[model samples]
Target chain A: MAAAAAERERVPFTFSAAGLDHPHIHSMVQGLLDAGAQLMHIYDENPDQANALRAKFQTGQVVQELSAILHSEVDLVATSIVPSKRGALGVQVLEHDKHFLSAKAPFTTMAQLHAAEDAVRRSGKKWAVFYSERLAVEAALLADGIVQEGLIGELFQLTGSGPHRLQAETRPAWFFDPGKNGGILCDIGSHQIEQLLHYARCKDAKVLHSKVANYAHPQYGDWQDFGDATLVTDTGVSQYFRVDWFTPEGLRVWGDGRTVLHGTNGFVELRKYTDVARSAVGDHLYVVTDEEEIYFPAKGKVGIPYFRQLIDDCVLGTETAMSQEHTFRAAALAIQAQEQAISLTKAGERR
Target chain B: MAAAAAERERVPFTFSAAGLDHPHIHSMVQGLLDAGAQLMHIYDENPDQANALRAKFQTGQVVQELSAILHSEVDLVATSIVPSKRGALGVQVLEHDKHFLSAKAPFTTMAQLHAAEDAVRRSGKKWAVFYSERLAVEAALLADGIVQEGLIGELFQLTGSGPHRLQAETRPAWFFDPGKNGGILCDIGSHQIEQLLHYARCKDAKVLHSKVANYAHPQYGDWQDFGDATLVTDTGVSQYFRVDWFTPEGLRVWGDGRTVLHGTNGFVELRKYTDVARSAVGDHLYVVTDEEEIYFPAKGKVGIPYFRQLIDDCVLGTETAMSQEHTFRAAALAIQAQEQAISLTKAGERR
Candidate 1:
């Protein structure tokens, strides 16, 4: 471990997978460290991994151990364990379940999620989500690009959707329980909600309408599938979104997935489709003017690699990174939509 | 006049004007007829002008003489004219006002001016307005071009402003009476209101807010000199208009002077500034687009000459030249705004 740390430092960074418990997190940390990350503070609450690492490392030489990883002094923090539930009481536990199920999960509720967010805010640091990293990057890029490039003339509408499918083989049984914020709406819808608000450039948005349903993975015996929502802003722009657990074509992820913006001079449409089952993809963004249509391919490095970008942005003081405050708004919107969808379902049932 | 009518009749169409007792009504009728229109019917309580025409020609012609004027059969309907301090009452009177105003003063109100708009269903006729004869031609050309080109997009916002300055020496005293619907906000504002509603393509638009004030032209004595009004539609579009009796330049006899439209992709601004003070100089229109601006010389036409176009479209069973429903909607919006302005003024005074 000491020799590995020395070798990593020689190249400019050290990767100590001391705190992270997930294999993906460990691999990502190793890749960044190998590519020249100066320091990495991987953390998890599991003591067995910490003790195992201590046995393999020299005392006061490599892989420093900390009592609590998040509370420790670290230049950057990356976590994939955000709780999926977003409301009061049982929400935090449900979110934790979702985090375990989804590989890298977002903080469950806004309040608990605010710990890392507040840290970023107080320290003026940048952070990124690891699981839905492409979306995180897309949200940041589109928000900045629209304002910078004057694309889409004026954003009129934004829509997003996520997978409603949940695997029964996933060990976390609490993942399917709504009481623990285990529903697909709260888990995946949160990401979309955040992205929509971000792209719309809205300061404060209120949910205009929403709908949610449970369709697939009935064995989980919970409402974790088929959620759709829409919102309108004070500026007259509208946003719509949907998330389904039982999509037959595997996981499809898109940034600026399906967007239509009507401007004074013309319009723009951005459509992205990814077939996770085949690992195949197709995407296109077209801006239609009065006389012509301009198209651009959306191709980039995929996944939560944006986490590294967030870390780099924080360390380097770059203006391009997405802020926690920005993500929080999306989170809030998602939670609001989820609650609204449930209310709508109840109202519809009543009618 | 007979010779001219005979010469015109040799062709497929003819136009002629007959005198009426009241200058206002005569001016209105003659204006329509002189524009190459065939008068189908005439109904007036005052038969003096008709009698004088008959005696002058020794034709024994009267209001009933209109039957002879029409080569084909004509429809003649007569109703008693009642002078009420409260102005014309009932939906029929308002509906008539709309038709007459559109035909005689296309820049004025449409049939929807009646308070009973709720009872009238849209018949989908094109109702075009022209502040002056020159503008009428240009607008006619544009409408024809749009129709020929099928350049149809959703109309967004339309705005217009006509001169407020009325010639006191030539104007009747009743023209200044607000109770008789003679105020600038009603007369001129009505034209703008109609234009806006048509441009915005809104239906059943309720006035959300309005402000009206008389700020200039104190010298007009009994008549208010200036009127400024603003209205917001339920769909979120806003409109503002101002009318002044004194535009440092001389009185404008034709065209409301300026109009503008803002669409999704671009904007169109039309301005007609006549050397009204100079030797009966003709007015000209300037159209500005996002890419370029051009001026079109107005031949001596002053109103929407599209009555023929409307008639032709009706005969051909095609879409009307303009949207009558939109015209009525605009008029309704203007009236509602005017009422709101009055209410606001009262509220302000109480404060």
Candidate 2:
């Protein structure tokens, strides 16, 4: 126990955060801490947010300016800013020769993605996205294992549906704006895009048809309640995914986050959130292969392996974690789809 | 009952079938028979198919030629032919001054839709599509009642998902051909289009974006295993829908068909075919409204009123079942989308 405590105190890499807007910063911090990262400093434009986080974590010093962390000895910056601002913050972090860990959908537009890409290329620093849908979900990890083991055969397609509850009144005002949220495809759809690239093992894909609509939320006309796109990867894997804000109150969770992967021989479905009305717990994976129709409640079976691997990559200068190109392309496809999507009103008018 | 049977034998309007290939003809026949229409004759290119139906129903006589039905004294001809041929046959039936009841996706192409429209203009015969999704699903009817009663308030969107088991072995060769099957959007997506027009109460709508992909079966190269589209009705009601042939073997029904209608006040989800893993019985309607959040099993409550209304219109020159233009436009949009949809392969390659 004394040796473990001594090792913890002798941790090599120190991490801090620049942007503290999204709630994901909590999960980001927890994952980093779990991966042996020592929090040193935290900074946000809003002092209250930084101070509250600082008090809760009871470690990181709250800094008044962003540059304080830049000048500090922090080895990495884990941040979750507004979608529109995440890219620039990432560039700043990487330019300081520090690794950058971003919340999913790090950028609202392709231009921002390109800028981040350039910064990462120039700085040779680790840049990773916390795509929680895949990275956090144990079912997804188990499913990925099954696919990698050739249990389901060659993968052909992935269909992802993220139906989220709209607690409209509780959200920040900027959440209702397309420019701020990056539309549905770039926001929630980013998770699906990353999942496709990872599970399908494809380098790039093209958006075939993409669309966004404000069905019931005409009050927030510029906001999209629903968005969908069809994509075909460079290797010929087809994908169709939808992200929507139409989850009913009966659902146990914030969303019925699910993904269905079709293979040449069989398929797997990851009920990442609530398993319908059947169970209170989530991570129910249904695997249908010729040999078996297995229902797995895969709790405790899978850990957040990405975080540990990412930490190793940041320290060792390895590409064992997710590649920067793959990350950038995934975000690029989502942002491109969001920018290219045609907007439609509930009454069938194209705006 | 005997008196009712005798009255049905002497019904004023006589109905025959021109395309007797699809299994839906049984439902069409049963619905029409229930509506006091006299079944007289049936015709198909394949005599065995026509004879099989003639023997099973033991009501309609087997006609050797299509022209016999066209030239006969039948007041209506119900048909479900190869999608590519459906429109021309409807045109032929309408030109002979007979009301036509078509299977969903009455036309495979915009040109075919236009031709049928012209024929209707010339002959003034009722042209109908059997969009059984809304017409046959009792839950949809119950939800429609709630909608018509203003329980859900101002309408905003309708999203539908129809996932059918491939049953690839039992399907005909033509079913694998895009040219014959009319692609996914024109085929299964027709039902969604019809439902959108009905629930949103919009006579016209535009297909903003449409997509189709062959994800699993590369053997059926041209066939689309999945299709989706975004649409907006003229009244500002937006729609996003998907149709896929990826229902796993675990599903009880051929499809876990469902529809959700979002309004200003609330939303209703109609589990049209089955309640999936939750329940065995179909037509499970869930309504989330201001007054109550309730689940209603409308299995026996909502009978096939469309057939009865259709019969009334056929003889009485009424438009109660569904408007001719509304039916045409729905099919037209589906066909238009099918034509306009870009194709992609399983490897994410745009073809």
Candidate 3:
């Protein structure tokens, strides 16, 4: 015990950054660095992206190649690469004897998800997903305790709405390509699916129905701006979620993401991003129970604990941060939802 | 115009109350009375119920037989009878050359709905339904104007949640009988389905999926306490609704019903019954658009106009209050959902 404590004090958990395709890599790195993890190296096809990250933290070497980070002395490698490439990259990281963490929708296709699952089994390395909507949002974290305490009783239904602004001109070419970035369900809907799995505490669920539509963005061929799906677990816990790239420019935030939990006793609603006209601050949790009706503004009060747990999970080969199975299942369900989605655009045309 | 105005002043629209199986008959009578409609007669199988209506209104003679009201000169007949009997009652009233207004879930089954439709066509008399959730609620009334003004843009999605406390002890025996009262979807779920149809501005939609569960009340045998369904209009406008009987005792109101509408430019959310933790005063409408975020507490500001319009429609042989087709379609869709519903209790058993 003394030796373990001495080692902890002697050297901190170290990780390298690879493929800064998504902006989420900044938060993922910052969260780990805040949790006392050392950032060793960074790499991106765009040198400016790697340099920008290095400048932001004033740490980590701007490496020239992906191989350099893959063969590094780091405990884990985190990436926010093009989603279709992420599955192969995760396999490569695991083969090189390091854990892998990727921005969600960890894989764009079912085949990719299958390969990643196989990689985790063969290499015995953790494959964690940065489901920041739940892990990083304070209101969601607060709701976790409320739900687990049986304050609301057994959860029976969940609904999630994620509306994101599409700054169409600013996005990369790959954003509209389904093969590169995945469809709307696989991309943004993954966050909602992950939270449902986490809060319901269930392993398996069946997708009942899913649909996608290109409501207003006809310029981007075959690019859907809206997607929704319904799923139910074996225990009859049902979930419905809608994700859209239709946030108007007049909104104050990037999105107005909300989650609602309906339980046997009462219900809980989380205004994760903003409370609209009421308040600009996020993490607004409104809970109604048998005892009381309460509103908890939990913005700064609850810190993100997932980062520290992930660091420990990487170093000790533990499953505390998130289970390997859950990471794959969430991604797999999203891919299934995307693959099976019926086109609503055709229905719209009939009108 | 002068003669019509003079005639309107001379003779107020008159109606008689027939069935008192549901308590909504009280509000139906009160609204019309307040709107200057004369309550001529009241009849129920239970004399005490008729006497209660007479005592509350200080008008409306308690008639002993249904034939007295049917043969009377009353222009319209409003009834809140047992749901399964309502369609037949409506047909009888129409055959007597009087407009019929029944409490919603106007028919218990598709066959009953078809009978009512035929009666309307044959007699050339109106068969209206009192969808009081939207007709009487002030916030819903307020939302109608806002939506018509195109402030939120073209609506693409709507979600309605209606939760009612199950005071099972106080309810009549027929309340739990699916054959007598219709299933939960055809009963309470009709309110949500009506609102969705009205807001989506579409006549027909497909029920993609539906499910019901006896979550907490198993003693009530096949009496589902929870139900939810997904539907979509031909215009690609999607809707989802969940109705339940799990409102806990601590709530200040009977239920905390809510409705949300997502449009092209923004979204609108209505806290119809109570805004928990905020105020007991209901009719809270929150509007989030491209230009502003605003909240409107519309309890006393908007009056129930459906009563007056319904009275006018009955007297003038006009379709003004609500289209006959819309009323029948709402009930038909709810019945379809109930019939096609998958039993969620079976799925719960697997867990």
Model 3 chain A: which ten-residue window has the lowest total lDDT? Answer: A1-10
lDDT of each: 0.42, 0.81, 0.87
Which docking band does candidate 2 fall into? acceptable
Ranking by lDDT: 3, 2, 1
Per-residue lDDT of model 3, residues A1-351, tens digit only? 344335556887789999999999999999989888889999999999999999999999999999998877798899999999999999999999898889988999888888888888899888899999999999999998999999888898898999998988889989999889999999999998998899999997888889888777777878888899989886779898999987766678888899999888988899998987788779999898987888889999988889888877766667877888888889989999999998878423423
> Model 1 in CAPRI terms: which quality?
incorrect
lDDT (10s digit) by residue, model 2, range A20-103: 888889998988888778899989988988988888788888888889988777889999888898889889888998999999
Better structure of 1 and 2 per TM-score: 2
Q: Clashing residue pairs, candidate 3?
A: none
User: Could you tell which candidate, 2 or 3, scores higher by DockQ?
Assistant: 3
Model 3 C-alpha RMSD to native: 1.9
Model 2 C-alpha lDDT versus the unseen true structure: 0.81
TM-score of chain B of each: 0.60, 0.94, 0.96
Docking class of 3: medium
